[model samples]
Target: MAKKKTTQDPALAQNRKARFNYAIEDTLEAGVVLTGTEIKSVRAGQITIGDGFVTINGGQAILTNVHIAPYENGNQFNVDPLRNRVLLLHKKQIVRLAVEAKEAGVTIVPLKVYLKHGFAKVLLGIGRGKKQYDKRQSIKKRDQERDLNRRFKN
Candidate 1:
């Protein structure tokens, strides 16, 4: 069989743990406000979003704890690697997310970061944290799928 091809670009950073730990209710795309050096680093795939999350403070969306490595040659222009960056989301979206996030065990997390139309964008997911038992169930389901795949292949 021929290999499949996709037009979408690979994500610069992804929070792989987010999907496993949270039961995502909704997902939306939002633009990221990055400085010159930060954008460069992102394009070069020097970012980590595993520990990053979104917060609505002062009616603005902020991306916190994401690390964009400094551009090698951007000496004076490079800012803090882990500085909080703003997310360019509409007022209505911000209000919705803020309200949802306030519910017990619900939160906003950065699911992925990718470049679109030459601009950096984040895939934010509004999710509720999963309990330990739910995680075990997820693992079991995944294992069953893998085993079934192997049996069919053989």
Candidate 2:
């Protein structure tokens, strides 16, 4: 008998600017609570996490500002595109993340959203905002690396 092959869905959305704007320290995978229409929209690759952020309230984590466009056929079942969604995380993890986020200039940001085993998951990053000089340094470093790679490839 031959084994069957399975292909996974690609990432629905990603916050590429997160790394450029912040220095990421830690990361965690989390599940998101979504309505049927929202999930459908997400599966259709109509989500954006560019300005999304995570916050802990009452020992639970919530995702805000992540936009999931209304489903075309959802009609009245479609909810707000920018509504807050709950993030499912362990209690201990929630406490730890909350504490880390409360530290000076630290925050929890959504790095990306993807499907895992047919369920939606979020990649959360604990990061600190980078200063202007830091951003400049990173840009310089990236340029130098690119130049080195080009020289070696030629």
Candidate 3:
């Protein structure tokens, strides 16, 4: 029997804070629409999805607040860093997300950005914002786990 091979995405950037601020309920892999210069910049890891958010405007899904630094060699035709980039998804998927986003406390956030077989992809998550107490509880749980692991090791 042959083992199935899974390819690793060429991850150029990620928003580490997303892990701490929200409890992700569901995740959707999306294709990002980008220009040539933007693609080059992303490939070089000059990008930030830290402040980005997913929104549905005019019946289309858009990724806003992402910063893709200008390509060093792309002096004449560089794309703007904060432009609203469209996210490619099925019509049904978009409609489902749009409805879900209308609920209170549910928001969409970017989790990671990477290249999949030469094309740029964004991993979007449907997340619920965590309360301060919830965050503290999570931290405490993590600390307990670490302490248990240390004890077991010794």
The models' CA-based lDDT, in order, is 0.94, 0.94, 0.91
TM-score of 3: 0.92
- For model 3, what is the C-alpha lDDT against the true structure? 0.91
TM-score of each: 0.94, 0.94, 0.92
**Residue 54 displacement in candidate 1 (angstroms):** 0.7
- TM-score attained by model 2: 0.94
Using lDDT as the yardstick, the better of models 1 and 3 is 1
Top-down lDDT ranking: 2, 1, 3
Candidate closer to the true structure by TM-score (higher is better), 2 or 3: 2
Better of 1 and 3 by TM-score: 1
Model 3 error, position 116 (Å): 0.9
What's the candidate order when arranged by decreasing TM-score?
Answer: 1, 2, 3
Residue 2 local lDDT, model 1: 100
**Per-residue lDDT for 43-94 in model 2, tens only?**
9999999999999999899999999999999999999999999999999999
Q: Candidate 1, after superposition: displacement of residue 124 in Å?
A: 0.3
- What residue runs in model 1 are displaced by over 4 Å at the alpha carbon? 1-7
Per-residue lDDT tens digits of candidate 1, residues 14-78? 89899999999999999999999999999999999999999889999999999999999999999
